[model samples]
Target: MDELTLRIYPSVRAAAPDLETPGLAGYAFARHAWLQAWADTFGAQAHIEPAIVVMAGVRIQMVLPLGITRRNGLRTLEFLGGIVTDYNAPAIDPDFARSLDATAVQALWRRITAALPSHDVVCLTRMPVTLDPPEGAVGERVPNPLALLPGVNAAGQARSVTFPDRYEALTGTLRPRFWADTQRCRRRLAEVGPIAFVVADDDAGMRALIVSLKRMKSRRWRETHSKDWFAVPAFSDFYDAMARIDLPEGRIHGSSLNVSGTAVAAHLGLVYRSRFYLLLIGWEADGWRRFSTGRLMTETLLRQAFDEGLRVFDFTVGEEAYKDDWANALMPLVRYDEAITARGRFATVLMTARDRLRARATQVAWLRRIVRWLAGRPLA
Candidate 1:
C-alpha cells in the first residue's frame, strides 16, 4: 500500500479543484460549492479548514470539510457545514472505502487527526453507514469509509424515501393512508383555489423564496420556543449565496406550492447525484394550515422527484413525526466526539450532561410547555 499524504487547506475554495472530483456517493452537501458558500459567508467566525488525503501525494483520496469554533472556552473542531449540512462525512472513492482494512483505515484516520490544528475536541456528526453506488444495481448498499472510525449513534436518525424508476411505480409504494391523505389534502387545497407547484428557475425568484422560507422558519421556531438558526446572519447569507450558484454535480432548487396564485408552502432543496436533499421548508401562516400545505408540498415534490427519475428523496437529519410518516427507511448517522486534551475531556463531560438534561426536558410535555412559556412563546 502506498503511503497516504494528508494536506490541510485554509478554506473550501482553496480545495475546490480537488473537491470537484466526485467520490463514493457524490454527496452534494460535502461538495466544494456547498461548503465553499458556507466558508465564504461564515468561515471567518468559524475558522474553516478543509483537509484532503491523497495517495502518493497525487490522486485524491478523501476530503474532510472541517472548521474550528470556540464554545464554553473550549476550542472545538467540527465539520464546516455545522448542523445545516445533514451528513458530516469525507468524500472517498467507493472502491477504496470498501476495500480498506481496519488497520489501514485507522492509520489514515490517525494521520488526518494528527494534521488537525490545536483544538480541545473534534466533533463530527451525521456520518452515514451505507452509501449507494452510481453504477450498481438499484437499492444496492456499499460500506462507507467514515464508519471505520469509532463513533456513537447520533441523537436523531436520518430518514429518506427511495423511489422507483417511474412515477406511477413510485406512487404505488406509498402507504394507503398516506396516499389517501395526500389526495384529500390536494382536494381541499384545490377547493380554496387552484394549487400549483412552481420551481424557482431564476436567481431572483430563488433568492426571494429563500428569504420567505427563513421568515416562515423563524415564525415556527418562535412558536415552539426553539432557537432560530436562520436568525444568524451567516446562515442566512450562506443559503442566499447558494441559491444563486449552480454546481456541476448539483444545484440549489426552490419549489413552492401556490394556492389561488399565492405561495402557500415552499422548500429550498438540493439536487445532486439523482437525489433530492430537502434542506429548508416553510408554509404560509394563513388559512393553509387546515389544508396541510406543507404535506401537500412534500407530496408534490416527491411526484416531481419521481418524474425526474431521482432515486432518493432525503429528509435529512430529524426525528419529526411527519418524517416518520413519510419515510420508508431510517438511516442511522453516527457522531464523533473525541477529546484531544485535558480541557477537552472536561468540556466533553459537561456537554454530555447538558445534552442529557435537554433531551429529558424535551421528553416531558409539561416541562417543554413551561420552557416555551418562559421563553415568551405563545401557546394556544
Candidate 2:
C-alpha cells in the first residue's frame, strides 16, 4: 500500500483541471463544475478550501469540496455547496474507496482533517452510505468512506422512488387513495385546457422556466413566511449557473407542467448517473392550487423517469409527507461532527442538545405543532 498524502487548494477553480480525470464516482454535487459554481457565487461570503488526497504510488484518490463560514465568532467547516447541496461526500476513486477498511478510513480521515485550515468545528452532513457509478461507467457501487467513520449519527434520510420493471407497477407502491387522488387531479387539471409536461430543451427555454420557478418559490415563501433562499443574490446565481452547466455524465434538467400554453408548475433538478435528483419544485399559488398541479407534475415526472429508463427518482433531502407518499426506498443519511478546539467543544455540545430537542419535538404531536407554529410553518 502506498502512503496517502493530502493537498489543499485555495479554490475549486484551481483544482478543476485535476478533477476532470476519468474513473471518479460520486454525486454531481462533488463535481468541479458544481463546486466551482458555488465558489464563484458565494466566495465573497464564504471561504472555500478544497482538498485533494492522493496515494503516493498511485493517482488521485479523493477530492473534498470544503469551506468555512463564521457565525457569531465561531468558524464552522462545512461542505462547499452549503444549504443547496443535498449530499455531502468526497468525489473519490472507486478503487481507492474499495481498498479501505473501517480502520484505514479513520486513519485517512485523521490525516485529511489535520490538514484542513483552522476552524472551530467540522460539520459534515447528508452523506450516503454508498457511491454508485454513473450510468455506462464500468464499476460497482462503492462504500462512502466518510459514512464509515466512528461516532457518526443518522442526520436524516433522503427518499427515492425506484422504478419497477413496468411503469404501471409504480402505482402499487403508493397508497391506492393517493394514486386515485392524483388521477382525479389530473382529470380536473385537464378540464381547464390542454395539459402537457414539457422539458426545457434549449437555453432560452431553460432560462424562462427558471424565472418562473423563482417567481413561484418567492411567492410561496412569502405566503408561508419562510426564509426564501432564492431571494439571496448569491444563492440565486449559484442555481442559475448550475442550470446552465453542461456536463457529459449529467446536467441540470428543467421541466414544467404547461396548461393552455402557460407553465403553472415547474421543477428544476439534476439528471445524473441514471437518477433524477429532485432539488427544486414550485407551483403557482392561485385558483390553480385547487387543481393540484404540483401533484400532477410529480406523477408526470415519474412517468418520464420510467420512459427514460432511469433507476431512481430522488426526492433529495427532506422529511416532507408528500415525498414519503411517493418514495419506495429511503436512503439513510449520516453526519460527522467534530470539535477541533475548546470553543468547538462547547459548540458541539450545544448542537447535540439542540438536535435532541428537535428529535423530541418530532415525537410529540403538540410539541411538533408548537415548534412549527413558532417557526411560522404550516401545521398539517
Candidate 3:
C-alpha cells in the first residue's frame, strides 16, 4: 500500500536507532543488542553492512543485519551473526509484514538483493518459516518473508518442546522408558552427594557460569577431536558479551547442575519471548560421565522452565540424538544462496560437492576412514 525503499547502513545502531524500543518485533537473535554484540566482537574480521527497508521514506519497515567478508579471495555477503546465530530473520514491522503476500515479498527481496553492495555470493541461513511474536504481544505467528522467496532450500531442523499447563503433564509426553531413565540418572547422581540446580541471579554469577561452560565445552571438543569454535577468540568473545546483555524482553540465562557444592554441568542460554533457548551446554567428563550429568542438567532446566511459565524449551539447531528424547516439535530451517560472479558460482559448486562428500562419508565407513586418513585426523 506504501512505496518502499531500501537503504544501507554501515552498522546495526545506524540502521535502527529505535532498536531498544519495546515496539520492535522479532526473534531475540535479530535484536539490535544481539547483532551489535556480534559486530563489536567480530568487526575486526568482517565488515558490518546492515540493509534497512523504509516505508514512505520515513518509517522503518525492516532491518536486514548483513555483513561481508573475504573468504578464499571472494567477498561474500551473509547474515551478521554467522554460525553463532541460530535463527536468522529480519526485524520487520508486524503491520507491514502482514500486508505483504508471497509475490510482493519476493519482488521486495529482489530489489533488496540488487541494491546490496558488490559481492560474490549471498548466503543467508537458519531462517524459520514463521516468527513467534515477542513476549506479551497479542497476535498470531508472523510468516517469515524471506522463507517465501525462491531458491530457498531446507538447511536443517531445530527441535523444541512446548510446555503444558503442568510440569508433570509435560514429562508425561516423553517416552516412559526415557523418563524413567532420566529419573534413575538423577537418583544415581544424587547418591554421589546432594544434587541441586542453580541459576545465576547476578552478573558475577552469570559470568562465572559462562566461564565454567567454556572450560567444559572446550575440553569435550578436544576429546572428540572436533573443530572447537570456542577456541577462536572472536567466537568466545561474542558469547561472553552475549551473556552480559540485558534486554527487556530477553536476558542471558546461565545455570548449573551442582553435586556436593561443585558444578558438574553448566548451560548458557537466552530467556526470550516466553521461551528458553538451550544454546550452549557442557558437562563434566571425568567421574561424572557415569552419572549422566548432561541429561540431569537438561531435566532440571525443563522443570525450571515450567516453573517460570515459559512456553517452550528450544534445543536450537542440530539433529543430535539426545534432542529426540525430549523434543515434541521440530521447526524446519531454510537457507538462500545466490551467486553474482564466476567465483561465487564456483564456490557454490564446491560447497555442494563438499556436503555430498560429507553425507556419503557418514554412510560409507571405508570412505570415511580413507578421508580421515588423508586428512591425518582421528575418528570423532
RMSD of each: 4.8, 4.5, 3.7
Report the lDDT of model 1 for residue 298.
Answer: 87
Candidate 2 on 1-380: residue-level lDDT in tens?
Answer: 43665677776777776656556778888777777777778765665554444333367777777777775467778877877788988777787888888898888877777777788887888899888674566756778988988889998888899899998888987789989988998888888999988999999999999999999998988898998888899989987888888765887889999999999999999898788988899999779999888888888888898899898899989887889889998888899888889988887776676557678998898877766665633211
Model 3 residue 207 CA deviation (Å) reads: 2.7
For candidate 1, list the clashing residue pairs, or say none: none
Against the true structure, whose lDDT is highest?
2
Off by more than 4 A, model 3: 16-18, 47-58, 346-380
Task: Work out the TM-score per prediction.
Answer: 0.87, 0.89, 0.89
Q: Which pairs of residues collide in candidate 2?
A: none
Clashes of 3: 0
Worst 10 residues of 3 by lDDT: 48-57
- Model 2 scores a TM of 0.89
Q: Give one digit per residue, the lDDT tens place, for model 1 in 1-380.
A: 44666677776777788777744454777777887777778775665554444342356766667767776677778877875677877676666666777677777778777777788887777778776664343545666766777655555578998876566666677788888988898888788888788899987778778877888888888888999888898877888888876676667789788877788889998888777888888887766688888888888888788778787899988777888777877888777778989988987786776556557778898767655554532211
Task: Indicate the worst ten consecutive residues by lDDT in candidate 1.
Answer: 371-380
